[model samples]
Target chain A: MHRIALQTLLFHRAKVAAALAGVAFATALMIIQIGLYEGLRSRASVLVNRLGGDLWIMAAGTSMVDDSELLATGAELPARAHPCVTSVRPAIVAWVPYRTPAGARHTLQLVGSDLRTAGPTHAYVPWSFAEGLPQDLLAQDRVAIDDGDLSRLGLAPPLVGSTLEIAERRVEVRGVTTGIRNVSLIPMVFADVETARTLAGAAPDGATYWLVDLADGSCGPSVARAIERDPRLDVMTREELASVTEEHVVTESGAGAALAFVALLGLVVGTVIVGQTLLSLVREHHKELGMLRAVGASRSELAQFVAWLSAFVAAMGGALGVILALLVQSGLGGRSVELHYGPGAILTGLAAVLVMCTVAGAASLASVLRLDVVKVLQ
Target chain B: MTDERGASANVLEARGVVFTHGTPPLETRVLHGVDLDIAPGELTVLMGPSGSGKTTLISILAGLLRPTRGRVVLGGSEISAMDDAEVTAVRRRTLGFVFQAFHLFPALTATDNVAEVLALSGTPIRVAREKARALLTRFGLEARLDHRPGELSAGQRQRVAIARAIVTSPRLVIADEPTVALDGPTAASVMELLREYVSAGTSVVLVTHDVRLVRASDRVVALEDGRVAYDGRGLAANPHGAPSGHDIHPPTPRSSEPVAGPEGA
Candidate 1:
């Protein structure tokens, strides 16, 4: 029976190929859409993911990092007094409008950390220079721009030393960093606390987020609970803040719903195409199936054969889809848009494709089972 | 007619079989009180005209269809009383079927199609293939073992179908117009193969309108208007044995006359 299933698929190479293509296309579409959604969510929380913090202290009702207002100066004083609080640094996060050399105006997410913070590399704004050393941003009025933002910022490659007017302040691009992008595709600029404040026109003591590092072996949840006791502030652990930010950008902003619809459409289209193709194949072989029945094939045997064929199609199609998705990912590399194909996404896409193929097979099997051997034999 | 070798030797028996078709408002009776007994080592050809219910009776006898009334017994099991699954099991284990269309799985090689039967019966694939190869080799299809049905000649395709049927070593082989699509020489060859199976103690029940098969059969059962017009050894030409005789059972009295029609027409 297994051999029969394989032979049937091979015998109708054209039909099987078409069916597999449909499944592959659908799977690829799903992978791309879901990857885009995940990319968006990742972008929404990229800053939080990079900033190693036990807790983030923000102004009350700050749903996302982008929309957060400046926390009052010395807002970390209360958290710093707690036993679990080891140290706290005022991290300034603000979007500053910049006019490019091409005269195109755009908003850039400016992140400011003290840069001297010790411990893990993520203890401060995590920026890796693509063109120049991290110390380049230490120069007065200098900031680092992501390499991905070169075209958007109207700057050419090796953007180091390029100067732009941000918030009426003259700032030189001292280094080009990579992999620092937000959901808006806006370039992210990293600078010292003084430079960020100057770019955002904030007071010397103002900061948007207080990046809190807890003492070793300290519990973040307990520290966060102690900090949130103050009604003037909202405190969240790093993971909690990342989740909130992602949720704010994805679900609250309607992007999640739209992407979900596209993914569903892909599934429906794939199922219909594959299902119809398989059904047609079965119909074309109706006489043979009838003959099988006449020669003593049970209904279960026929169903199992179809299932095996469907699984084969799905497995092959899923592999093709993954390859195509990787190609798409490679094509989009070095661009402002981010497409993520993590292991989770790949496994999910494969599972969905297998399910779709199984559904198609079962639909075709229903027709096969209903076939009247007596009529078909005639 | 009763089997001279006794009931146990009878591979198939039908008693007072009546089959009908359609809803009550348009009910049509096809077979009326038909009875038959097929014994081992004999080739019985069911002869009838087009619309004479030969196929329906054959289906009932082969356990492919249930008669509206009356029972059919195959190899001591009352198949007509069995459920669909049970009948299917019986067909799979005890019966082999050859059809007019040579319904071989088109995608499978000649050997694979034959091997499918053995595989279904739980034989390991390698052994099944070897058995299938040997059987086809015996049927002079050794060179065409790997050829698909589309690549085979009509006669070779029928031979594959025959091989598929007998691969499981079934007790009875039922054929419906098995040679209708073949040339004279090929048809003769197919019948010769079937005769060989019968010689090995397997019973064969075949349905055909071809008179050429009449001379080769061990017995001939002729049906007309659904009822068995004749049940005996050799071709009788007429139901009553005379070449030009009238109806064997005088027409039923007008008040008791039963209506008859083709089963699938």
Candidate 2:
């Protein structure tokens, strides 16, 4: 029985490939489309990872430091008194597009960090070194530029020692960085709190948020309540902040909902294409099915054959689709657009592809339901 | 051979079967009324030219087509009144049909095609494959077991079809021009394979335009138009069992003009 299932699918290997190709196109399109959305969200709040803080304390209702603002609040003081406060850093965002000394130009987000534990905040752009020398980015007038931004600025990649013009002020590119793409969607240059405040022309003591890094024993929920209890400010964890960003886009910017609708469209088109392709294959083999039936195969066995074939095709198509999306990732180079792919999305895409295949298989599956040996023999 | 597998006589009894095709202007009744009774284990040959209603009669006998009005009983089951699906179920376990074209599935190997019916029939995979291989080997096709129909000669493919038809051990086998696709030797070989089932008491109903099989068949039924022109014992036209009415040419060659396409009849 298993061999028959294998042989039946391979018997029309071409048709199976066609069906899978249809499904693969859909799965790939949806996955990559979502990848872009995720990439955009990551870029919008990348400062979270670098902030070295498990908890972000900010003025009431402060949504983002780069684009969001809040009135002066007591978000900084009490967070420092907690036993979990290994360290706290004042961080602000200053995004300004500037040309390089090498006659190239692009935008970079300038993030400030506390003189202490600043590496976790902005220094992560160069990538946090678990085993290498950490870039000391909080040096007075020194900043760190990402490898991607360095290349874009007409400078050689890994540009460890270079100069960046911080709005008519000279700031040395002290260290080259990595991982800037995951969060900023572009490039980032990190400097000390003093330098960032100077560049943005803001008051010296004004930090939009206090990033508090917890000690090893601190419980996330307990610390969250402790921080948010400060009446003067609100606190958001990384995961909470991400969901909020998604909610904001879904409800406010409409990007989240728009993409969801497109993804739904993809499902419809994909299922229709895959469904028709498989159904036609079944129609072509009506005589064969009759022979099988006359031989004594139950309707369920026939349905199994259709489903297995459709699933195999859909899975293959989905994998190829993902590869295709990755191929086009570089095409979005200049648009400050990026794409992210992780195991979670991959597995989800796979599950979705299987579902799509099952839907497509419904058409071919009709043969099992409607076949009558008497008609086929005629 | 009168073997144990040869069924006791009286396997099928058909009564007053009236068959029609299509509706409106295209409507046509092919069989006014037909009746037949066959004993188990006997080979029944239905011989006639195109449009003589031979195929239609064969379909009715095997319970593949519905009679516009009539009751056909097979192995004691009144199948004419059954629904299409019920009829197919009855056909699956009780009857088998050998087609003129030897319609073996192109994708499956010879053995798989033979085994496919067994698989569909709810036979265990291991047992079904074993039986399928044994059947193919019995038919002198062991060498071509894994070859697809497209890869086999017409005779070999016909033998595979025969194996597939008989693999389920149905009580009756109805063959419609089963050997037409083969050359003389292969056709004879195919006929011999089908005859082997008679030892198991399985009745064989072979329909053909060929006169070659007329003499060897246990019973011969001549279909003239939609009605049976002749049904006689001992197969041969002669009552003495010697070559009867020996002639170099047919006494009356009915209009040889091709009446419809090959599938039409």
Provide the overall lDDT of each model, using Cα atoms, as 2-decimal numbers.
0.82, 0.69
**Candidate 2 docking quality: incorrect, acceptable, medium or high:** acceptable
Per-prediction backbone clash count: 0, 21
Question: How displaced is residue A61 in candidate 2, in Å?
Answer: 6.9
Give the Cα-based TM-score of candidate 2 against the true structure.
0.79
Worst 10 residues of 1 chain A by lDDT: A117-126
Model 2 lDDT tens row, A1-378: 446556766787787676667777777777776786777676655566545467777767765545545326455666667776676667777676667777566777776666555333334333543222333666677777666555566677445566777667778766655556534355677676777777766677767666666776346667767777766777887566655755564446777678778877877788888888778877776777666655445576677767766766775788787777667766765445667766766666677788888887886787767876666766
Stretches of model 1 off by over 4 angstroms after superposition: A102-104, A118-122, A216-231, B1-7, B235-265
Note the DockQ of each predicted structure: 0.62, 0.31
Model 1 agreement with the true structure over A257-364: per-residue lDDT tens digits: 998898888888888888988888788878888878887888888787778778788988888988888899999987767887888888888888988998888778
Q: What is the TM-score of chain B in candidate 2?
A: 0.83
In lDDT terms, how accurate is model 1?
Answer: 0.82
* Error at A346, model 2, angstroms: 2.6
